[model samples]
Target: MIVLGVDPGSRVTGFGLVEKRGNRMACVHAGIIRPEKAACFQEKLHLLFRSLVAIIQEFQPSEMAIEDIFYAKNVKSALKLGHARGALLIAAAHCGVGIFEYTPLEIKKSVVGYGRGTKEQVQYMMKMILGIRGDLHLDATDALAAAVCHLNTASFRAAAHHAGGYAK
Candidate 1:
């Protein structure tokens, strides 16, 4: 199964793709999409939408996992994040990919074994889990973590079903 994970933001959106085969997972691609700083907010949204659509078309992922919005101190910042997430969701829907959303805490717990894990801890765990070398942007790593979290959840559900346990 191929999964695309997205970390939406008004300025820079991060994306990562992972392919899972059997019990192994590999990073297929990862990068960030940065809109022009000088551009208007609406233009930035358009740019993000177009870029995400292109990515969805190119990767052709079977599903998309996205980080859900967390409460922000600033209302404007939260609203901008909502807009960015909307664009990403629209792109995924248009590409006919299944979408799953996970909270930041859920992703952290799945990836780092702690719901309140620090960013550094999450990054270190991502490198360890993915066997990734070299530096990785924090946003990109978070996106990858989201994908990994989804894969883990799906695996658990499948195993439970096979065992005739609760699965939903």
Candidate 2:
């Protein structure tokens, strides 16, 4: 299964794609979608939407895993994130991709084996798991971690369903 994971931000959104075959996971691509500076809010949003739609088209992922909005002390930051997330969801929906939402805690635990793991810890585990070299800044790595989390969780759920048959 091909999974696209997104970490939404107004200034710079991070995305990563991974494919799972059998029990192995491999990275297809990972990068940040940065909006040009000095652009107005509306223009930046439009750029984000366009870039995300193009990414969906290019990757053609079967599923999209997005981080759920976490409460923030800064309301402005939270709202902007929500707007970016809305664009991401819309783009994925337009491509007929199923969307899966994972909380920050769930993502962290799946990636780092601890819910309160530090960013460095998560990044370390991401690199170790994917056998990636060099550095992946926190945002991008976090997005990758979200993808890994969803892949593991969704695979588990699928196996359980097959094992247990139908559950209402």
Candidate 3:
């Protein structure tokens, strides 16, 4: 299965496409999406939405795994994040992709074996897991981690569905 993972932000959004290959995983693509600094909030949202729509159309991923909502100390920052996330969600749905949400805790635990793992740890582990080398932006690494988390959790999610359980 191909999973498109997203780490949403107001200034910079990260995205990664991961495909399961037998017992392994490979990164099909990964990068950050950032509108120009001069962009207004609405323009930024529009650009993000259009960019992601193009990405989804190009990659045609089977599923999209995005970070779930979380509390932020700054209200303005949180609101902008929510707006960005909304754009991302609309893009995926528009392209007919199944959407899944994972909490930061779940994503960290799945990727690093620690719910509160540090970002540096998550970055190091992503390289090891994907057998990739070179530095990646924290947002990009987190996006990749979200994809890996989905791959690791897929089996459980499937079993839960069969057992009449639910996923959130």
Candidate 4:
């Protein structure tokens, strides 16, 4: 299965792609989308939407995993993040990709084995899990973590179903 994960931000949106074969996961691509700094906010959003649409068309992922909104200290910042996320979600929907949302805590726990793991920890574990090499941007790593989390959760659910409906 090919999965695309997105970590949305107003200034820089991160994206990662992974492919799952049997029990192994491989990183296909990872990068960030940065809109022009001088562009208006609405234009930035439009750019985000267009970039994501192109990405979806190019990758043709079977599923898209995104990080859900969390409480933010600043209302304006949170709203901007929501706008970015909305654009990504719309692009995925337009491409007919199955959308999966996960919380930051869930992503961290799935990748790093702790809900409160630091970004460094999550990045390290992502590299270890995906056999990634060299330095990776935090946002891209987080996006990859979201994809890995969804894969793990989906596999667990399937296993439980095969095991005669085991409980969570």
Clash count list over all predictions: 0, 0, 0, 0
The segments of candidate 4 whose C-alpha lies over 4 angstroms from its true place after superposition are 166-168
lDDT of 3 at 18: 90
Cα miss at 36, model 2 (Å)? 1.8
lDDT of 4 by residue, 1-168 (tens): 989999899999889998999999989999889999999999999998999889888988899999999989999999999999998899899889999999999999898889999989988988998999998899999989999998999899999999899746
Give the alpha carbon lDDT tens digit for every residue of 1-168 in model 3.
889999999899999899998879988888999999998999999999999999888888999999998879999889999999999999999899999999999999999999999989998998999887888888888999999999888977777899999964
Instruction: Show where candidate 3 strays beyond 4 Å.
Output: 159-168
Q: What TM-score against the true fold does each predicted structure earn?
A: 0.96, 0.94, 0.93, 0.96
lDDT of 2 by residue, 10-87 (tens): 998888888888888878888898888899888888887888789889988899899999879999999989988998
CA lDDT, candidate 1, residue 112: 91
Point out where model 2 deviates above 4 Å. Answer: 165-168
Lowest summed lDDT window (length 10), candidate 4:
159-168
Evaluate all candidate structures by whole-model CA lDDT and list the values in order: 0.91, 0.87, 0.91, 0.91
The superposed Cα distance between candidate 1 and the true structure at residue 99, in angstroms, equals 0.3
Candidate 1: residue 64 lDDT (0-100)? 94
Q: Check candidate 3 and list the clashing pairs.
A: none
